[model samples]
Target: MRKILVVGAGQSGLQLALGLQAHGYEVTLMSNRTADEIRYGRVMSTQCMFHTALQHERDLGLNFWESQAPRMAGIGVSVSGPGAERLVDWVGRLDGYAQSVDQRVKMAGWLDTFAQRGGQLVIHGAAVSDLDYFARVYDLVLVAAGKGELVSMFARDAARSPFTRPQRSLAAAYVHGLGPRPEHPDTEVARCNLVPGVGELLVTSTLTTSGRADLLFWEGVPGGPVDVFQGVTDPAEHLALTLDLMERFVPWEHARTSRVELTDAGGVLVGRYTPVVRQPVAHLPGGGLAFGVADVVVTNDPLTGQGANTASKCAAAYLRAILDHGDAEFDEAWMRRTFERFWAQTAGPATKWTNVMLGEPPEHVLTLIGAAGALPRVADRFANGFDDPADFENYFFEAEKTEAYLSEVAGG
Candidate 1:
């Protein structure tokens, strides 16, 4: 059996490792923390898995929280002016529901399952030098660690990378006591409240360490008013500042979250990172090479909420490529081909859609959003784009295409 060494135990690494083990590959997975440590650790991300990504987990038999996690039926977008006046409000229903189970719960459960399935679980931080040693033993070494020193293994693809600095300062807190959506009282909706120049505030239902709760995520444009979480360590203090910022920029969300408090002391997290795309192949010292996957290669700003979904898709794509390669030697040519296949099929479209959302949205996009409010078909299509970003190429990405599509939708 082909032996594979996977560095990092995040969504991409664990999924690939577990899948390989199930397929009769000898898989060794390394994690910085054990299952219990991750279970009790600080919150990692605001991950919402759409239908396509969810299917990947189901195929691997890893959807452990499907029944308990809250179902996100649609997305509600509200744009506010400088004075906090709601300018445009629309709700777009998705064709299939999305779900967000806390990574702490999901990853911990997956780590345990990996061990149970006879996959080697090494609880240690894997470094570049360590990866070099592993490359000799394993047929293939894959780095899926989303952050830290392991990311530096890959060099940045400057030609494809768009930003040198972070687009937004991010702060998130998982909380309970959030009120229901005003439009759809019974259904849980992913709400995006955008303030054109300032930033965005997103509220979505998620399963936290304490069970189901709403995730209040803030993407503050650097140096803007909402970018005020520096030096804040306490979760309660972070929640207070978040509520204060919401009251100023998104009063409607503030009203719903006013009484909400952090689910635990470790429920809040604050940080910033540049959205970047790097070369998937990384050269290690001592003449070894390792392949980078998911966030390590293509990290996007979370404004579009595509991080976890993209990682899941990357794992699935890479898994397929590995399975198809059979007993072929995993040389540089094969590695490049494997990454190229995934880039063309999944990562490229996701990166484009995310970058478009981060930059100055064009007039056509604004018109499309406005049109979505009046047309349910338009709204449904727009909402489903999150599940399959490749669909954006048809109408959402280009100005001419979007205008023509909108005209056709209007029957004009």
Candidate 2:
């Protein structure tokens, strides 16, 4: 059996490791975090898996949903502007899955499954100091390290970038004591509130064993005063100010509870460095010493609330590529094929959706919206794109749909 070493055993890391093992590869995962450390804690940030990504969980046959699973029948979108409010509710069902999953449970469950299947898990704090040694020992060195120092090596060359600027930084916090309104049980169903001028924010009901329900808030405050994130001496005052501002400028209509108990005691701050990398490194030679793999690739902004979903899809795509290639020489052809598959399957939609949420909507977004509003079935598919990635390439980007939507928009 080909032995694979997966670094940074977080959400994406655990998914890739488990997928590889299930496909008959011998996988060993190493992370600085121990199981004990992982269990008693919530993850670094709030993550909600899209319904389709939940399908990814099912495809792997992982049973993380048995004891606790959150359900979303459909999504509600509230778009507000100065002195105006528009509420669009799409009651179409989720087809076959939950719209979101708690990352803490998902990772913990994944780690447990990896161990149960005879895969090795190590809790050593010793970082991989030598990529050369790693490449020699493992058939493949998969870096699932999130946005960390390891990503520096795989930075995309500036000349190849397609975008003029990097992604704007985001600050998010997850907390409990915020519950959805009883009438909007369906609203607990993932929803995105587009506060055009201020910023876009995603609020959802998190599923967890902890009786305390959690609400996540993410904002894209460009050049705002909250730059010195963790440096703030009084987080309570900061949170109060943020809440006050949110109440003043934005219409968070559905959320019944606005006051949140921030669980991030360390005063974590979310800020993005521009240029989110249109092209991430596909392979690293010598496991990184001679060449490095594109591990910490950040595709979509948190504004769209698709980051975790996109990451899961990419993880699945990468696993398929590795399994198809087997232990054969990791050649350029293999790398190209894998990268192409990911670009088409994951990155394409992520970039498109990010642009839409972040003010660079494709010409088709308006058309698609108009069509959907006029036709429920069409709207269902358009809204469902959040869960089904294939829609990215198949429906919205389809030539016929594009032309029709463009024509309709022009006529109006």
Candidate 3:
């Protein structure tokens, strides 16, 4: 049996460890916190898994909260115009529904599930020096943890990474009492509101540790008026600031948040990270090599809301690569090739889309979003791109292509 050490208990690490265990491999997972600790800890991310990413979990029998989570049927986009006016508003349908299960709920449950399967779980913080020793015992040592000393092991790929600093200051609050959107009172979808120079506000219903809740996320352009979360540690203050931004920029969204209250003391979060792509293989001091996975290798801005989606696909891809290798040496060469294959298929497209969205929308991109308001055909395709971003390559980048495609839509 191939012994593998997966350091990190996140979406990618846990999924890969569980998948390997199901196949009868010896897998040991090292996490800084236990299941209970994570469940009671502060919220981690604002994630909604679309169809393709969700299927990866379903295939592994890891969709424990599927039925309880909110069904985000589609995506609604509202661009804030001059003072409470919506310059453009439209809801695009997704072929298959998307769902958001709070990481506190999903990760905590997954941690317990992994242990119940007889997989070895170590509760400890891993470091570079620790990996040097771990490298001697396991057939493979994979870094699933995206932060701390482990992340520094993988060097940044400068050629692939564009920004050296965070583009947006992020703040999220998970709470109860949010009223339903009157426009789609009967439907549940992620409503993305753009306030131009201010930033973006994304609201979605999710299943949390306590039960059903809503996530109010603000992605503010750094140094801008919307970047107001700095120095605000109190949860009430954080939420109040979030509401104020909504009222001033997107009253339509604020109307739904009037009755909002935090689900728990740990329901609010604030942080930011620069978008980057790192070298896939990390070299150990003892002549050993470790492989990077998911966010560890390619960290994109959450502007596109693809963090968890990318992690799910990355875990699945690495599992296949490892399984197909049989007893072959999991050497540096194999690791590089495996990550590159996944980068092309999933990471590349997501990173490209996210980086593009982090910047001001190009004239062609703006035109595409406007056209979607009047054209369901265009709207559906744009919304569905969140599920499979590769489709955007055909019409998203070049202005000429977008114009040509819209012209065809008119004629058709």
Q: Which wins on TM-score, candidate 1 or candidate 3?
A: 3
Candidate 2 lDDT, tens digit per residue, 24-52?
Answer: 88888877776656656644555666666
Model 3 whole-model lDDT (C-alpha atoms): 0.93
Higher-ranked by lDDT: 2 or 3: 3
Task: Please report the candidate that would top TM-score against the real structure.
Answer: 3
Q: Candidate 1 regions off by >4 Å? A: none
Q: Which runs in model 3 stand beyond 4 Å of their true positions? A: none
Cα miss at 409, model 1 (Å)? 0.9
Candidate 2, pairs of clashing residues: 166-274, 166-275, 169-272, 284-291, 284-292, 285-291
Each prediction's TM-score against the native?
Answer: 0.98, 0.81, 0.99
lDDT tens digits, residue span 47-78, model 3:
98999999999999998989989899999998
User: Which ten residues in a row are the worst by lDDT in model 3?
Assistant: 75-84
Report, for every candidate in turn, its global Cα lDDT versus the true structure.
0.90, 0.60, 0.93
Model 3: clashing residue pairs? none
Worst 10 residues of 1 by lDDT: 252-261
Model 2: lDDT of residue 202: 63
